[model samples]
Target chain A: MTYRIDNLQYANWSEKIFRQMREGGVDAVHVTISYHENFRETVLNFEQWNRWFEQFPDLIFHGQWGSDVRKARETGRTAIFFGFQNPSPIEDDIDLVEILHKLGARFMQLTYNNQSLLATGCYEADDSGITRMGKQVIKEMNRVGLVIDMSHSADRSTIEAAEISERPITITHANLHSWQPALRNKRDDVVRAVTENGGMMGFSMYPHHLKDKSNCTVESFCEMIARAAETFGAEHFGLGSDLCQDQPDSIVEWMRVGRWSKEIDYGEGSAAAPGFPPQPDWFKDNRDFGNIENGLRKIGFSESETAGIMGNNWLRFYDENFGPQQI
Target chain B: MTYRIDNLQYANWSEKIFRQMREGGVDAVHVTISYHENFRETVLNFEQWNRWFEQFPDLIFHGQWGSDVRKARETGRTAIFFGFQNPSPIEDDIDLVEILHKLGARFMQLTYNNQSLLATGCYEADDSGITRMGKQVIKEMNRVGLVIDMSHSADRSTIEAAEISERPITITHANLHSWQPALRNKRDDVVRAVTENGGMMGFSMYPHHLKDKSNCTVESFCEMIARAAETFGAEHFGLGSDLCQDQPDSIVEWMRVGRWSKEIDYGEGSAAAPGFPPQPDWFKDNRDFGNIENGLRKIGFSESETAGIMGNNWLRFYDENFGPQQI
Candidate 1:
C-alpha cells in the first residue's frame, strides 16, 4: 500500500493536527524539534515530546527508524520523526551529532537562515562553504545515522555537504528557485547536485516559496513538479509543505530570530509582513496532502511515479539512510 | 629535559597539593574528576576545575596535549590532565567520547571495580570480553584522542581493549597481581597483553596494591617494578600513584559504592576496615616522588632507566598518545 509521509512540518502540534494527519493518512512526519535551541534546551524540547508520546499513544509515537513508518501504517497512527532545522542544537561540539542521533533526532540542517559554525546560510551575504568543523561533523554524522538536511544552507555549503557526505544528504523543505525566485527556494544547480547524489528534495507548500504566494493553485504546483521531474527524477521528490498551521505570529518571530539575532530578520518578506507567510489554500494543512497526490496524477505522472513523489520515495530513502553505516 | 609526571592522583585539590607538586618538581599530573557521575554532573565537575584553573594560574592549569606538560615544566607549574575512573561520564553514549575529549578528558576507564555498560569491571565474577557498545566506543575513542583506559576493568576486557584499540591504550593506574594479588591488581598475563601491544602500564603506588599494605617498604615496591620491567620491558612502565590524599572516609565510600549499590562494598578490604588504606611512609605525598627515584637507583637500574620509571616513560607515552590520530 502507498503510504503518505511529509518529510518536513513545524506545526503547532496538538490533538487537532494529529487528527488531521490521521484524516489525511499521514503515515509518518519529520517534525522540527529544534529551531535554534542549544544542546540542553533541545533536550528539554525532547523531554516535552516524550510527554507527548506518552500522552498521545493512539494518535502518534516516536519514530527512530524507517520501519516505524510501516508500523505507524499498520497501527493506523502517525509516526513523528524528530529533526532539527538548525545545527544550533549541537552548538560547537561535533560529538553531539551522534548524541543527538541517539536521542532520536533523525535530521539536522547545516544552517537555518544565517551563517553557522558548520556552513553559511542562504541569507548570508557571502557563502564561505563548509567550515573546518563542518567536515569532521559530516563524517561523524555519516558514521552515525543522522541525515544531513541542507534546506537553508548557502549554495556553496549545500553543494559541498552533498559532495563531502558519504551518504546522501537532504533538502527536507524548499521549492526549486528556478520555478519561484525566493531566497529560501533552492536554485536548479543545488537541486541537480542533491538529486544526482541520490539525495532528496521535498517541495514546500509554504506561500513564500510558491510562484504567486497564497494564490498559487494545485495545477501550478503540480505542473512545477512535472517540470522538476523531467530534470530531477520524481523519485527524488516529496512533499515537505513547511507547514506551520495555527501558529501565532510570535512563534514565527522566534523561529526566524531565535537567540542568535538581536535585530529582527524579515526573512523572505518586508518589514510590513515579517511573520510566516500564509500557506496556499490548496495545501493549507495535513488534510490537504491528498489534493497534491491527485494533482500529481493529473499532471501526467505515472501511477508509480506519483506514488513515489507522495511518500513512497521518502520511505525508501529512510530505509536506505536512517541507520548506522554498515561496517 | 626530563620532566616529572604523575600518571594518576585524585586529591581533595587545594593550594597545599599544588605547592607540594611544585616542591616535588612535578610537571604534569593526571587527575581523576569523576567516579560515577553522569554527563551533566561531569560537566559540573569540569566547571569546578575551570574555576580552580582560574584561581591558581601560577600553580596549575588544564593539560590537553603532551606539550602542555613541557609548558608546565617551563613555567614551574603542574599541568593537571583530567580523567574519569569510570565510564559513567559518557553514560552509555559512544558520541560523548569525542565531546569529553574536547572538554579535556584525556583518560576514561571502561569500568571501575564493577560492571559498566561498556565492559566488565575487575570486581565482576564473569568477564564478558567487551559489550557491543564497548567495541564501537573503543573505535570512536581511538579515532579521537581519548585514551581507552581499562585500569579498573576485568582482565578479559582489559586485554581485549588493548588488542582492539588501534592506538596504544593505557592502564593508567594499577599494580601487577603477581606481586601483591590485590583485587584491583592485574595478573601477569594482563600486563603482558598491554605491554606487548605497545600500551603503557602505570604501576599503582596505593597502599592496598603494595605487598604488605601500608607497611611495604620503598625497596620492596621498587623491586616489584624492577621485576615487572624485566618481564614487560622498562619502557612500558611508569608511576601512577593512586593517591587520594586529604579526602575523607565518606569520599572513599562514595567511590566504592557510588549509586549502583546501596549496600556498602569494602572493595579492597573487609567491612571492618572499608576506608582507604594508609600510604607507605616512603610515598605519602607528591613531595615523596624523589624517594621512588632513589629506590629505583638503589634497585640497580641505569640512571636513564630510573628516570624513565619515575616519569620520563609516561612523558614519552603522553607525547605519543595524547593527540588525535595522524591520518
Candidate 2:
C-alpha cells in the first residue's frame, strides 16, 4: 500500500487544515506537537481533537511529541510517535524524555534550523556539531522509540545525531543542499550517511526548496527521484510534502519569527524566495505536481518504483519504529 | 484582615518571591501572564504548581488570561484575572472569550506595547484606535465577564476598549507619558478614560520609562503613581513594578523583537532600554533605592500610603473581581 505522509507541521496543524488534507489526497501525516515558544496562536489541536478523531477514522496520524506517543493515543487516529525540534523545552531534565515519549511523539528533528541547546542548525555559519545536551537528547531519543529526523537541521548536528543514534536517522523532507544551496536544505554528506546507515529520506514538495522554482517542472522532480534513488536507494526514498494548502500570512509571519529567535532584516515589507514571493498565499504547486497521486504520475515512474516512492518507503520506516499498520 | 496584591507576574512568582512578598509586606499580586508571544511558557508550571498551592494558601494571582480564574480554591492561587495584554490570541474567535472564561480568563487588555490584531500598542509611532477585531474582542471580553485592562495598549485602542466595555477598565502597570513622554508610558486621554470607566491604574518600575533613571529613585515611580492618582483616584492606583527579575538575555531578545515582530535598532549590539548596552542589571531599581522594599520607602509615603504603594490597593482590586476573598 502506498502511504503518503506530510512531514513538517508548524502553523498548519488545525481543523481547517484537516479537511483540506482530505481534499488534497493525503492518506497519512506525521504531526509534530511541542510546547512551542510562540503559543499566542493555537498550539495543540487537541481543542478539536475529539471531532478530528471521530471524523477521519482511516487517516493515519504519526504524532511527534517527545517519547511515548503510543500511550497518549486516542482510539481513532494513527499511532503517534514522539519527536523534538529543540531540546530547550525539556530544559535540564533528562527524565522528561521518557515522560514526553509517553505523551506520543514518535519522530523528532534536533535543531529547528539554528543553534539550540542541543545542536547547531544547518544555517549557522559555524558547523559545530551537537552540544552535550544534544548528545544526551540523542542518547535518550535512542533509548526511547523516537526516531531522529534531520530536515531543517544544520549539517554538523544532522551528522552527529545520525552517528549517535542507535537506529538510522531520517532526512524527513528536504531537497539536497547541493541542489538548492539554501540553509533549509541538507548537505550531500547527510544524504550519504542516511543511505549508508539504512535510514530513510523523504523528498518534500515545497517549491522554494526545490532547485530553481522558475525552471522546475514534473520532469525536474522526476530527475530528482532518479538522482535521490541512485543516491539514497529505492527502499529508502518516500514522499512527504511539507505542504500547507490553506494556511495563511500569519503562519508565514510565525515562520519568519520562529525561524530565528533574534531579529534581523528579513528584507522589505516581506521577503521572497527565488521564484516565490514573500506571501505564502502566493504559493502554488507550479511544477505539475498535483494532488499527491497526480504528483507521482507527473514524475513518470513505473508502478513498482512509483509505489515505493509514494508510501511504501515511509511505511517501512514507520514500521521499523511503531510496527506496520494492520489492515 | 488586610489583603494586598501587586499587579505584576513578570517576577518569577517563585517560592522565593512569595517569601519576599510576605517579607516585603505584600498580600496578593496581579501577575502578568502574557506580553510576548510565548503561550507555552505562561502556564503548566508542572514542577512548581503544587508548591504554589501549598504556600500562602490565600494568595491571588491576577493574570492577563481574559476571565475570572476559579481554580484558585483548589490551587490556593487565587487567579483574579482578565487579559491585561490583549495579544489578539482571541484572534477571530469572539466566542473564545466565554470559552476562555470557562477556562479561567477574566481581565482583557486591548493591546500590549505595540500592535496586535485588535489595536496598536503603546509604543507604536502612529496611533490608530481600535481595529474592527479589537472592537469585537473588547465587546466579547466585556460580554463574557472579562474586565478590560489598558496597560501597554495603544492610546487609541485603550480609549476605545475602555469606552466600549460595559464594566470598569484598568491601566495596570503604566506611567504618565506626559511626564516622561515615552513609547511605554500612557497618554492623558487614555488615562481619563480609565477613571471615567471606574477602573484602576497600576504604576510600573521600569527605569528608561521614567524621567531620568538617574535623577529618580523610588521617588520617581511614586511621582508617576501620584500623578496617575491625581488624575484618577487613590483607590484606582496600585504597584505593578513590571519588575522582571532573573530575566536573562534570551528574554530581553524576546522583548526587543516584541515591539513590532521586527527588532528595531537600539544601538551597536544594543536594543535601548532593557537591552541597553551592558551597563548594569537592576539599574532601574537604581543604586539609591536599594531594592523593591527600600525603593518603596524612598517614595516618602505615610504608613497607610506606603502600605497602598506596597500592594494593598491591588488586593482591593482583586476582591473586586475574584469575589471578595473566600474568608
* lDDT per residue (tens digit) for residues A119-216 in model 1: 77787655657754567678888889899999998898899999999999999999988889999888899998888989999999989999999899
Candidate 1 local Cα displacement, residue A291, angstroms: 33
Off by over 4 Å in 1: A1-327
After superposition on all CA atoms, what RMSD does each candidate show versus the true structure?
Answer: 14.9, 14.6
lDDT of 2 by residue, B204-317 (tens): 666555676435554555666666666666666676666665566566565544422222434113434545322223333212123544545565556676565555665555
The candidate that wins on TM-score is 1
Using Cα atoms, each model's DockQ against the true complex is 0.02, 0.02
Please tell me how candidate 2 rates in CAPRI terms: incorrect
CA lDDT of each candidate?
0.86, 0.55
**Tens-digit lDDT string for candidate 1 (B107-145):** 999888765556677876556566545666787888788
Model 1 chain A — which ten-residue stretch has the worst lDDT?
A257-266
lDDT of 2 by residue, A1-327 (tens): 444444554434455555455554444566555423322112243334435566665543444431212322233334333345544344434455565566555666666654444555565445456654456667676777667777767776678777887777888778777667656766778888876787888776666666665345655566777777777677787765566444575554544445222243242123453112321222242222244445456566667777777666666666566421222
